[model samples]
Target chain A: MSEILKMAWRNIWRNRRRTLITASSVLFAVFFAIVMRSMQLGTYSNMTANVVGAYTGYAQVQAQGYWDDKTLDNSLDWTPQAEQAVLAHPRVVGLVPRFDSFALAASDSSSKGVGVVGVLPATEDSMSRLSDKLLEGRLPAPTAAEVLVAERLAVFLKIGLGDTLALIGMGYQGISAVGEYPVVGIVRLPSPQLNASLVYTSLENAQELFAAEGRLTSVVLTLDDPDFAEPTCAELAASLPEGLVALPWQELMPELVQQIESDQASGFLILGILYVIVGFGIFGTLLMMLAERRREMGVMMAVGMGRRALATMVGAEMVLLGTLGTLAGMAAAFPMVLYLHHNPILLEGEMAQAMLNLGVEPIVPFALEPGFFVWQGLLVAALVAVASLHPLLSILKLNVINALRA
Target chain B: MNVIEIENLSKEYQTPAAKVRAVDGVSLRFERGEFAAIVGPSGSGKTTLLNLLGGLDQATAGSIRIAGTDLASLRPGQLIDFRKDNIGFVFQSYNLIPVLTALENVEFVMQLQGRPKAERRARAVELLEAVGLGERLDSRPGQLSGGQQQRVAVARALASKPQFVLADEPTANLDSRSALTLLEIMERLNREEGATFIFSTHDPRVVAKARRVIWLEDGKVVSDKTQEPTI
Candidate 1:
């Protein structure tokens, strides 16, 4: 085996140009797969951070039947005891109670349906980065009845800071209710859907407008360890009162998980195509090499080398080439992926807004997971190994006398 | 003791046009330490007879026994092992692997026999030096002249110190001077080292130097002659 390996190594280097061309193809394929996968994963991470962490926190606690029905009757009573129980968990970093309702806002001839979230001013300030996201005016006062609307919604309404807007919706008892509140601030969210239709107000004003005192839609919880969210939520669910349930952020925004999974699956398909192209490139070069070394193979066989030994030598050459190429590709991809992970490429123009509307961040970053790189490297090695079987099988059928003649 | 025994050996190759009988109803024997030659024209089955005797090709209907073992009865893997262990081959084309240096090429057979590196290297160097290729040990076959390359092939065949060596027109590609030199070296080895040498060739010089000659024509042995007893 050692002799065969040594001979195989020397044979590969005999034609330096051919070896290099084949190796480079494999390297480029591996590099492309790694970088593309990293970027796709990074984009997904960024989207999850922007949409989940910035808005919904990592997990939420709601009334047992709230998510399915989402009616005013299913709202939880925000009791001090329940709040203290949730907040005292070791993993819980912050918690905020929210009151949510659907309403219509009309300004002049334009009207739009909006999701209105009523939050405590001090709690919202501490739990979310919404205050920093404000583009105009100031955060509404804790005791005031003023509201904050998204910048895009404000534009469509032709409304500015300090402008009075009429909000009309069904109140807690299912009665038709109306309120006049001033738009105290305008904010921008990364998601176009949220930016176009979301409005925020104080908890007191929400209770007054909706006639729903002490009723809250959900309680959002942030965790110091994002990955612990699901398990912690499960634990909370087990310990919570019979009428309450805990839901992770992924369950709240299932589309995000589905999109990421589908994107990765499609990316893998693309990577497979890339490997095919690289395989063909390497196979072509190897075939040419085998053709050129016909006499050499014949000589070895004529000199008492068994057919299996010759095939083994050929296979060993391919494995060596694959290993080196994969290593080179990894070396190149590491820094490239790392650089992109930190500094993502931001999309602009209509496409940017279009992506934002779909709840994806405009910037596409690169991410690295140890498993992803290992799988990619193994995939490349396996492709090369498969490609090498051609020469191995051919050598078995090779006629020693004919090869000698050649 | 007879090293190679052939009994009613016949070899036939199937071609698209017809079945070509390369060796028909041939029987011969080679004793240990004997230098013999099988001389014939092209397509006269001399090489075919050598192939059968060396266990490289099977006889269509015959038996071949080398050193008391029936070559025809061995399995495929056993045949390969038999060839590697007991038989050595020297082709007209020298057949040295181009990528291997002369020393490495000679060491290849020993490596196959599972010989240690140190011993294989020592034997390879000794054989190469005996063949006057000591200085050219590191040079590849492509770098050597036809004669030097053939010398390396001879060294490689003898590297494993097999029981018998088969040479099929070993001098066919060389000039007269190199041919004589190669034959002389092989003849001397046969005499001094007790190694059996068999040649299948039409080269008159090679035939003249053989102690025994089997003459074949049209796939049949026409004459079996032992040279006039030398004084």
Candidate 2:
């Protein structure tokens, strides 16, 4: 076996130019695959951070029909027992209980419909970092009769700090939910959809206004690790009280998941085409190699070398080529990705504007997921193996007498 | 005792035009330690006959019993092993593995036979010395001259200690001097090692040195005779 391997190694280098060209195809395939996949995943990562991380928590516990209806009647009952049941899971580190409803906000002559979210000030700050996004004044106190209006909503209403804002809507069980309060702060939100008509107040004020005391529209959970969100949500939902479902952000924001999936599918299609091209390149090189070495192979077999052994030697050569290209590609791609990940490439012009409109940052960061390295390497190796089958078939079907004559 | 017994050997090829018989029915026998040459004209089936005897080609209709083992009865893998153990071949082109050095090429067959490394190396060295290539042990086939490459091929063929060695027009590609040198080495090895040697050749010089010569014309044996070899 060692002798065979030695021969195989020497055989590949017999035609140095051809070997390098074939190996180069695999190298570039892996390199482009890694870089492209990293960029795409990084962009998706940024979007996930902006949307799921900042707006929706990793997972949420809500009444079964709440996501579909989002009405006050679909809200869950908030009690010590319910909160304890949610917090019992180890992954669930913190929860921000919210009373979410739509209402008409009017400042003097101006009026607009808005999403009113009543949150526990401290927990909401911890999970959503709402205080970090405060554009003016401060967050509303838990018992204060003041509200925080989104920057865009404040602009639309022509309202500012200490301005009187009136809210009117149907409350729980057909009661007229109406209140007026001072706007204490203006908050900037990342999502344009969320920023357009958002009003935040203390949970107590919301429950009081709605006449639905001790009720919550949802409790957004902050997890220790966001990657485990789906499994944790599944476990939480299985154990939660009837009529309540724990939902991961994927389910909470399915359009984002669908978009990522479609983009990923397209990315894989490009990668598949790349492998096919590289496969043919390798096959072409092997075909030439085999055609030139036909008589040598015949002589070897005529002198007692088995077809199986010759095939193994050829197989080993291709494996070496694949490994060489994969390693070199990873070596070339890793540090580049690492540098870009640390210092992301910021977008400009229409690309930046497009990103901003999508509520995402205008920078692209490479994802250094080890899976990218392993998967790309294995894929190229498998491609090399698949390409080798053509030559192996030729060898198996070789006619020693004819080859020797050739 | 007969080392190779062929009874009614025949080989045919189907062309787009018609069935062409490359080797018509021919019966022959070869004894151990004999220096024999199968002489024929072009397309007279000399090479095909050698290929069939070496297990490199299958006969259309025949039974070839080498050392009492019927060649037709072995499976493909078994035939390969049988060839590894029993047959050695030298092609006219000095078809040494270009990647291997002279010494490594000689050791290659023994390695396939799963001989110990030390023994394979030692025997390869001895064979190279016997073939007067002891000094060029490390030289690759490309680095060697035409005469030197055939010497390496001869050394490689004898390295396996096979029942017989088959040389197909071994002198065809060499100049007269190189051919004469290669024939001298082969004749000496046949005499000293008692290794059976069979050649398919049109060279009269090869026929002159053969202890026995079998002549073929149009795929049929015209004559078989044992004669005293010329020095």
Candidate 3:
């Protein structure tokens, strides 16, 4: 066995140029595959951070029909038991309980429809970092009769800080939800749509105005690890009161998930095409190896070396080359991935604008995880192993007499 | 003292026109410790007989018994093992494994036989030394002279301690000096170690060194005679 391995190893280096060329294909495969996949995943990561960071958090608990119908009747009471139930999980980092409803915002001479969100002052401030986004004035006090309007919504209503804004809409059921409060703050949001339509105020003031006191439309949870969001959401949903469904950001914003999934599918397709090309490259090299060593193979077999042994030696050579090449590729791609991870490539021009318009951060980053690299390496190695079937077929039917003659 | 016995051995090859009988109903026997040569023309069955004796190609009709073990009864895989343990082959091209050092090439068959490392190494060194390649043990075949490479092949053939060695035009690719040196080493092994040698050749030098010469013509041994070596 050692003899065979020594022979197989030395045999690969006999034609250094050919071996290097063959291995270069594998190297290129691993490099491009890992980098491409990293880019795709990293872009999704950035987009997830961008979108989720803006408002959705990682998971949300809302009334059963509230997602389909954003009316106040479907809202849940902000009971202490409900808040404690969600915060019980060790993974929970922050929470924002909110009551959101849409109403007409009328100033003295201007009127526009806007999304009104009532939030617990401190928790919303920490989860959404709402105060840091304030363009003017402080966050509205939780119990104060003041509202935080989005810049665009304030612009449309022709109202500024200290100006009164009226909100009129149907509350819980059949009750007229109406109020007029002074705009204490103007906040600039990341999403243009939200900036144009959102109105944030204290939970007390919102419940008072809506005639639905102590009720919350949603409780957004920020987790320590976002990857655990779905499972946590499941556990939370199972334990929560009826008429409440815990939804991860994926379910809450399925369009984003669909977009990332489509990108991932295409990314894998591109990788599949790369593997085929590399497979052919490997096949070509092995064909040349068999062609060049036809007589040697014949002589070995003619001397009573079994078909199995010869084929194993040939296969071992491919594996050695592939292992070396992919490992080298992993080594080579590591720094590039690490660099891209730290200094992400920023999107420019229309691409940046488009990404921004879609509420995603405009950058292409690389995910530099060891698992991704190891998985890609194993995949290439497996492809090389499978490609060795070519040699097995050729050797099984090898005519020692004919080969010797050749 | 017969190490190999054959009865009506035959081999046929299919052609586009008709079937060609490569070895046709030839009967012969090789004695232990005998240095014999099968001499023939280009189209004669000398190589085919050697292939049959070595269990390389299946016989079309008849049986070959090597040391009382019937070649016909052994399966293909079993034949390979039997050949590995009993028959050593030296090809015309001095077919040393180019990737391995001469010593490793010699050790390859012994390794296949699952010999211990110390025994394989000692036997390989002893064989190479006996073949006048003691100083070039570590050299690769590519780095050796044609004569030296053939000597390594000889050592590799005998590494498994086969009962007999089969050579198919073993001296065909060597110059007169290298060929003579190789023949001398093989003759010495036959004389001193009592190793049986049977090779096919058209070369007169090889025919002259053999203690017995079998003249094969058109797949039949027309003349089989024993003669004293001229040298």
Largest DockQ belongs to which candidate?
2
Identify the runs in model 2 with alpha carbons over 4 angstroms from their true place.
Answer: none
lDDT by residue (A1-406, candidate 3, tens digit) is: 6677888999999999989998998899999998998898888888888788668888998989988888888898767777778888788877888888888989998888888899887888887778878999989897888899998888888889899999998888769989989989999887889989999889988988888888889889888999898899988876777778889999988988998899899999999999999998988889889999999998888777888999989988888999988988888898999999999999999999888777777888888778898898789878987888877788988887788877
- Clash count for candidate 3 is 0
Q: Give the TM-score of candidate 3.
A: 0.97
> Against the unseen true structure, what C-alpha lDDT does each candidate score?
0.85, 0.90, 0.88
What lDDT is obtained when candidate 1 is compared to the true structure? 0.85
> Where does model 3 sit among the CAPRI classes?
medium
Candidate 1 clashing pairs? Answer: A38-A367
Q: Is candidate 1 or 3 superior in DockQ? A: 3
The per-residue C-alpha lDDT of model 2 at residue A187 equals 96
List fnat, each candidate: 0.41, 0.87, 0.51
Q: Which scores higher on DockQ, 2 or 3?
A: 2
Residue A89, candidate 3: Cα error in Å is 3.0
Quote the lDDT for A51 in model 1: 79
Score residue B25 of candidate 2 by CA lDDT: 93
**Candidate 1 wrongly placed segments (more than 4 Å):** A57-59, A77-96, A106-112, A120-128, A141-145, A156-158, A164-166, A173-182, A203-214, A221-250, A257-266, A348-361, A396-406, B228-231
